[model samples]
Target: MEDRSVRRQLSLLQTSFLLIYIYRNDSCRSTQFASTEGTTSARLPPVSKFGTVKVSGNSMLPAYRDGDSLFVSWVDGASALSAVGKSIIGKAVVIEREERPGIFLVKRVKNFQDGNYWVEGDGPGSTDSRTWGWVKPDEIIGVVLFRYKKAKPLVSE
Candidate 1:
């Protein structure tokens, strides 16, 4: 009886994990617009509009803390400047750090001038436009839609 109970619990746990994984992956896929070489326009047929990214630092502070996950609406470089010709000032955005390739950072859009953007963090210690100067449109990955906090695991005593 004890062995059977343990097996049932394990099976239940596995099923729970599988369901969560599927849901999470489904929510994470976002639309991506790839620009053609030498062209300032994005290719057609955009996929889903939403995506997820995890925060890794305190740069955003009160607005977004470390370990928080954000759901964003992706905006590709060519589309941001051409297709969506609206101002993004004061909006939180995910940007690919110019100095450190492959690393992404969350910052607020502070200024826009001559087709470039200046971003800053709410936290004073953040490394942003003050350190790296203006960010090109191509560096912006997505606009933050909402933040999701990680759920704490339940402890069974």
Candidate 2:
């Protein structure tokens, strides 16, 4: 999955509100940039909720490296709780870490059982459910639909 080609292709899907800034550390303060500011012309299907996630670590390496930008379809606490294992299982999600409160973590949903979601990072030695245990559905912020890594040069037709 080292190919940045897939990221370049998916980067075409976008929306105004989906623009976001990347951070290099857990600290929220950092230089900001808009993902949709002339990089893409694609449009997201008219949906009520959508947002972006910027990778600052290698936890999801291979599928999503550091600096990769992900366009997510946001699912609020209420909707996520009701959906349970139906919509989120087997999908990559941005979740509010219960331990860190406002901090968010991106991981793939591995399973749902006993009112909790088993999420894990794609890379070995990555910290996730293996260390924190299952996450509540309400903790899930969104599900990833498309990714755009800025480092990948877009291929013009």
Candidate 3:
């Protein structure tokens, strides 16, 4: 069984029209997340909106600790992101190229060349685009809006 606490957001099922709109409009940035429903407290920020998400890995250290959830946004297109020159705001993307696959990577966008962008972790320990290579525009999932700090574990609990 999936642990409710450990498991994070669940995206909603997509309709053909929605997918069509995303492709046709070419503004397919936000991904509509399906809510679990019935659990108000568990309701996470809309996946489409630049909102907070829980971190489930340790690839990003120092800047992010294990189990430390954060907020990110799904921004697309190198041209649209040309103005962005700071750290990537919680842009966790999946690498699906022939070389990389099924990897959930989070970091900031440094430089954009051609159709790809350079991504890396803030900490030296982090292995980001430096290790993998250039990040294509389609690989980016979204930009992080914020992350709620994980609560310290109690000795008793």
Candidate 4:
């Protein structure tokens, strides 16, 4: 766990459609001096499911922590990443890890390597895919779109 609010938030995210608000362009205020908010380039992939989870261990610290609520989105880009575009790190994913052959483990992708990915905690001393070894491409599911927690330095690069 998490608190009641986080649970409620997760329930809502699980049911509603969502989009990741990535910044693509910048806008400025005219006339009076003012600052425009960062613009978002939302080309959101279709959402199949959504939910929130409080990180339980340091395995994903710096990126996540115990009690941290994450807004996870399940999408269709499960079979491959080149098909999904961009790195899946910092994104919530439902990838298959040999740890649980039949069950789907949802976690952030973190980064990839020569067939292996380096996943760690945004918090201190968090273990991740790095601890578990390479995850097959067929395992990845989706990306995390939102989170509610204090930011911290990542334990792994």
Candidate 5:
């Protein structure tokens, strides 16, 4: 009876995890997301906005601290291509790692060469295009719009 109970609990836990995974992936790939404070863009509609992603490491240390959630939006290649020298250069973006499927990294755009982008993190600890070489546009998820950080005290006495 105890073994059966344990098995049931495990099944429920697995189901919960699966659901969460699906939801996260769906939100990441699609432009749609819940109407949340940090997720929505002030100037654009939610449908044409970026998804939120939480920082997990110190790669972007000074620019972005760990645990800070940022709004990342998919880039419109048409518009970017229309304007030369304005595709993704000098922008911070969230890119999908080609080496490891489903893994995403947030880095700044250094340059554009051929049809690929050179991305690097603000901090020296980052292992970005410097190590992986150029990243294809398809691998880039979107540009980071803004960061949502906890507000500091209004009057720190």
Candidate 6:
């Protein structure tokens, strides 16, 4: 019957749309970043020295959003108090919550004074140094270098 034919066509269209959505939102896409440490090409540093982190909250909005992936370069907390860590000021960093052993947060380095780091988030509702006090040098995990934003769904409007 014609009704059955129309139903089949609609089902096929729906299936095609689903496939397109899945392809657009695929998370298994390549995550490799080429290394330029040894070459003089003046590109980004080696990907081997960086680690990826997925943002989970909106605390770092405007700069980073939830579900966004970040590439970070690891740091040595022991040397963070020295001049080596001074460069960390004004950069966004991943910090392991001092109060909560396993919790992590992304915040911008506000200041480095009195052997402590003052970090804050860009979002007004962010829970950063204002709520958690100063962040210790050893709490800093790494500095953010790049961000891979999640694909935004298309709106027909």
TM-score for every candidate vs. truth?
0.65, 0.64, 0.49, 0.47, 0.60, 0.62
On TM-score, the candidate that comes out on top is 1
Which pairs in model 6 have colliding backbones?
Answer: none
For model 3, residues 55-93, the per-residue Cα lDDT tens digits are 444555665655565645545545445456334434543
What is model 2's C-alpha RMSD? 10.3
lDDT of 2 by residue, 22-53 (tens): 22211333221112111222223223455555
The candidate, 4 or 5, that scores higher on lDDT is: 5
Whole-model lDDT per candidate: 0.67, 0.63, 0.48, 0.45, 0.63, 0.65
Q: Count the backbone clashes (under 3 Å) in each candidate.
A: 0, 0, 22, 20, 1, 0
- Arranged by lDDT with the best first, the candidates are 1, 6, 5, 2, 3, 4
Tell me how far candidate 5 lies from the true structure as C-alpha RMSD in angstroms. 15.3
Which residue pairs in model 1 clash with each other? none
Clashing pairs in 5: 50-73
Q: Per-residue lDDT for 1-157 in model 6, tens only?
A: 9997796777667666645644543443323221111111112222344566667767777887766778677666657446565677888887775576545577899998778889988878777788778888888767888885434443343
Q: Write the per-residue lDDT of candidate 4 for residues 21-67, one digit (tens) a residue.
A: 21111121111100011111222233235544334444444555455
**What is the number of residue pairs that collide in model 2?**
0
Report the C-alpha lDDT of model 1 over 1-157, residue by residue, as the tens digit. Answer: 9997796787668667645753755555432211111112222322445566667767788888776778677777656655553467888887775565555678989888877888888887788889889998888878888875544454454
RMSD of each: 9.8, 10.3, 13.6, 17.2, 15.3, 13.8
Model 3 worst lDDT run, 10 consecutive residues: 34-43
C-alpha lDDT of candidate 1 relative to the true structure: 0.67
